[model samples]
Target: MHRLSRALLRALPRAPLLRQPPGPGRLLPAALRPGSRGGLSTRPRREPPAAPQRPAAQGPGGEEEQFVFPEYVAEPGPAPAREPPAAPGRPERRPREKRQHRVTGRPDPSVPPSGVSCSGCGAELHCRDPAVPGYLPSEKYRSLMGGQPGGSEGQGALGRVVCQRCWLLVHHQQALHMQVSREQYRNLVSAALRSPPRHGRRPLVLYMVDMLDLPDSVLQDLPQLVGAGSNILVVGNKVDLLPGDSPDYLKRFRKQLLRSCAHVGILPAAQGTGGQVARTGSQNLVDVHLISAKTGYGVEELISKLQRSWKCNGDVYLVGATNSGKSTLFNTLLQSDYCKSKASEVISRATISPWPGTTLNLLKFPIINPTSDRLFRRQERLKAEAEKTEEQLSDDEQKYLKCLKKQGYLIGRVGRTFQQQKSKAVIEFDPDELSFSMEEEPVFSSNKPKERVEFTYNELKDARWFFDTPGIVKENCVLNLLTEKEVKLVLPTHAIVPRTFVLKPGMVLFLGALGRIDYLQGAKSSWFSVVASNLLPVHVTTLEKADSIYQKHAGKTLLKVPMGGEERMKEFPPLIPQEITLEGIGTLEAVADIKLSSAGWVAITAHLEDKLQLRAYTPEGTTLIIRKPPLLPHIVDIKGNRIRGSASYRTKKPPPLVENLKANGTNKQIKRVSKI
Candidate 1:
């Protein structure tokens, strides 16, 4: 039965599966063949036509008698040589222009849209590559540009902005610091100084200063930048970082700023309006207003002042140091002023980072003024309000009063400083226009001192534009010595929780790796209040083992707050240590202080100064300033007590931020504080 079944299956081969079809032979037409239409059988493959041969011709230098296909064939190329790989060590630049859109086949229902550009940085935006700056998902880009998410228009909005690089740095807490060479800085500064006013109208300057980082070089160099005649509004920012609000402290702050400026010969320019002025020194060109950009404390007043300045002058320049909070102040002002500020946030017009030089190129923001009808009503309201009594003013009217009051205090302080020093007569200005009013002092040779602006403003139609320039980065600031991570840890993010350390003669203290202080002499067991960031990592050791401890634990054990783990700790150079011995009879009995440049300072209060040695250390290139302790009030002593007469003021936590500084020069100058 099995044999019969196998034979039957073999015979039935055709029944199980069809046999392979035979290859086609020369076949008749479909009409002539069976079961076919009027068509020929399968079409035959055809070979490519060969190039026609030409008769041999006599040639001058031709080697081949018969011209066969040429050995070397050349055709026009599509892309340039750099189409794929860029030169090594240089970053590949994206093309400014975009490619054409791609259309699908057949129905062509799905077509790739044209490339979009980032409104913020001007880089072409793309949804494909996630690692690059302009990469954004099609849906997110649309949403950011004000379109609904998942809309059919997956193509991004023309007004949408913010490249991926800025997005990450702004929102993701990147430790990126933007550094430019001193030459570049100088060029940018000069351009800003020489920026021509729009419509040939007067240009005003918003001189932003970091109050906490007072006594800076830029403050002294203002006269050189804007000339002695530019209208200057001294915007004192980061006031919230201060520990106290005592009236006396405010006065001291102003004087310190004036003194610093005076030392550098930055006397204000003579005023435009000749008025009966007091013999205030050449400080009238400056109008100081203290405010906290982070907390929006004085932003409202600043905005009002800015608006008034705009109406008075067509051009306004916002200038400051990299870490002086210019970017923060800019963002805050826009958010409060512009209708499309949300769009600005998406683009992060100017990133607010702890790192200095975050704002590199010049940025322009437009101011949209109200219509004439609305402007007239607003003007009437303002004029009427000016006539109203202070008691009748509403909350909104009083909101900016605090900052407004500061302007007067600053003026009074400057006057007092001039009264004491008998320096150049201080010039006073109109508080509203910031124009100097110096009728007493002769106008320094009357030809406008060659600095008077040539622009004239006949009619004010709401100044439409404001310019922002990159902040200057000073070289000697201790903030420049720290790593970005170290900066976040060392700069106060909240109210500074003053850390007190008890020390005998042989004790040493380290302010991270940036600064080190050693008490070589312990006179009367005096108390020193170490006021610094709460996050600062401090290690106390005996003076005998201080050097070795630092050598072994430069960034590892004793100084370890960067949070980059052990690997980062290895990058810091050996701390540059310098010791100053106070052996004079005065050194024994008088109290002396040591400043860590701009970071913080240490005061050695001893009845017996007996050979007190202050061994200061900094990063290799950083400058160390050991000056008289800052004349700040409200200091606490070791017994957990505040000093008499000056009560300590506890301010609210500061906005999370870090002071940024960059080195502009390599020259090192060491200043010592002499005992008073």
Candidate 2:
């Protein structure tokens, strides 16, 4: 019966299958088709044809009209061009306009905004790359831009913003590593100098150099950079780091510094005629003042000189090499009468650290107008304070001065005028801000945390500014190769205590692993006084074993500085030796100074007839300078009797602190504690 049925179906001429209309009772497709296997066959379902529209009525002209549905209408433009297919395993990039924004609809904060810069370093603010200068994290940037919790509420908060680098330096005493070339630093300074001043006046350049580092800190071509006609005030910073308080020593040091400056072409070479000053180009060395930015020694005189010589004629720029105390001086000046009273209250402090390249940008504060009225008020305040004897001073003032005496011999306190005192009372002090005052000594304890002062923009837009330019990185500075921890060990915090050692021929002295001095040839034993941070340990050994000892002790506790043991030593540059020959002037005087980069210097003292030949070793690529007429010629006298069994000498006690102040045409003396 099945075969008969199949034959009958096949004979029916194989009628074409018709799709059922859309309805609830649509029949299922037959499982087996005629002349096919008895199994269900898969087929694509077809869509129903669209319904036709009714015809439109004829017009008065009696012509029949056609009708069209809205769905059938085509767009009235050219088709969009298709994008090419992406390559294998790569993401397809979309147009920037169609891409999602990083922060809401706003532009990326990592891209610097127009006319915006960090208040601390003056680098253009960006949040993109931490490896670059002026990098701030996005969240912190949002806070600075008023988009997050700690952000500024208005334009007034602009001056408070600092880049992450400066923030880390100022608060955590940590520094971010950045690879900035010396040429790049020069370009930054050149660009700043090329910019026209706001009032169209020549700017005064305050050329600063480290007292300890000598020529390395002195810029040889300063006159050329600041314009030959510009006035330059050569400032010697970190005087407190040099031992001895004798006024005569300071005078001699100043003369030696001037000569050194001349040697480096910063000043003109001395003429053969007499002790007459010669002109180099049109630039004049306005004056050379040695000051301790940390202890405020000679800072007041510096400010007075600024007011007297330069006045408010133009803006003042502080320029120097890296780790030369430029930022410290800036901070000191900001709180003193040098800065405008209103501006000082609003301006932020620069980041001061032992790390090289700490100041990578131009920071500025408005200079105070040294008008007769303001000068008179300042003089009166100083006179009032000077009139008071040590007995007359308040207990707090007495205690503060006592503490300062231990830090330096010549300390100057920042005195505020009546108006400033009155204004200070009205302004509320933020407890969270860093406590900076002439009275407060620096505390290094980690347990007692300190905070940074918040700042804002100065309202006095017309006032002249005191610019703090980026420090020029010295090519041969040892600090450049040191880690932050090692730097702190090398840089002096407290007053340096001169450590003298008696060395004979064939003997070697090591200043940690940073410097090595060998008395290779000498007629008699000589006194080698070390002028360096007390934190550096001085080890005396025979020249024969010097290399072996250094290799074994470097990066260990014996040679403290590069303190990561074998791992650190592997990366550290090997010590390179340089031969130096010097003639002795006198036994009491230091005939020459062997400068071991920024690590420290060794002042050699020998008999008048002694002609000493020495070999000095420093890290590869570091500077090894032989400074004649040593900075402190009488440094040998500053130590106590030699130790009985060792090559070391006892550190002499610091001299008594005395302040000579003139009051009512009479000189008055203020006494502080004699010893710690």
Q: For model 1, where is the 10-residue window of minimal lDDT? A: 667-676
For all candidates in order, the CA lDDT equals 0.51, 0.71
TM-score of 2: 0.73
Please, what are the lDDT tens digits per residue for candidate 2 over residues 1-676?
5565677677454544556453433333444343345533444223334454533333323211111212212222533334456899989977545432232222354344424567777776666667668776766566556763233452334556787777777667777787677888988887777667667677878888888888777777665667656667888887765666354666766787788777665664335457776676466676788887877767776888898864435888888888788888998888888886655656777777778877788888877778898889888876776566666777998798788766665565665553343323344455545565655654443443223344344445577778888988787779878988899988877667787877788888888899989899989989998888777777777777788888898999877878999999999999999988887877888888899998999999998989999999999989898887678778888877764456666677464343424333232223221111
lDDT of 1 by residue, 153-205 (tens): 44434445665555656666554332347568657766776777676665677
After superposition, which runs of candidate 2 have C-alpha atoms over 4 Å from their true positions?
A: 1-115, 148-158, 197-200, 245-247, 268-280, 310-312, 418-461, 656-676
Which candidate wins on TM-score?
2
- Please give the distance, in angstroms, between residue 252's alpha carbon in candidate 2 and its true position after superposition: 1.2
In angstroms, the error of model 2 at 621 is 0.3
Model 2: which ten-residue window has the lowest total lDDT?
Answer: 63-72
Q: Quote the lDDT for 434 in model 2.
A: 59
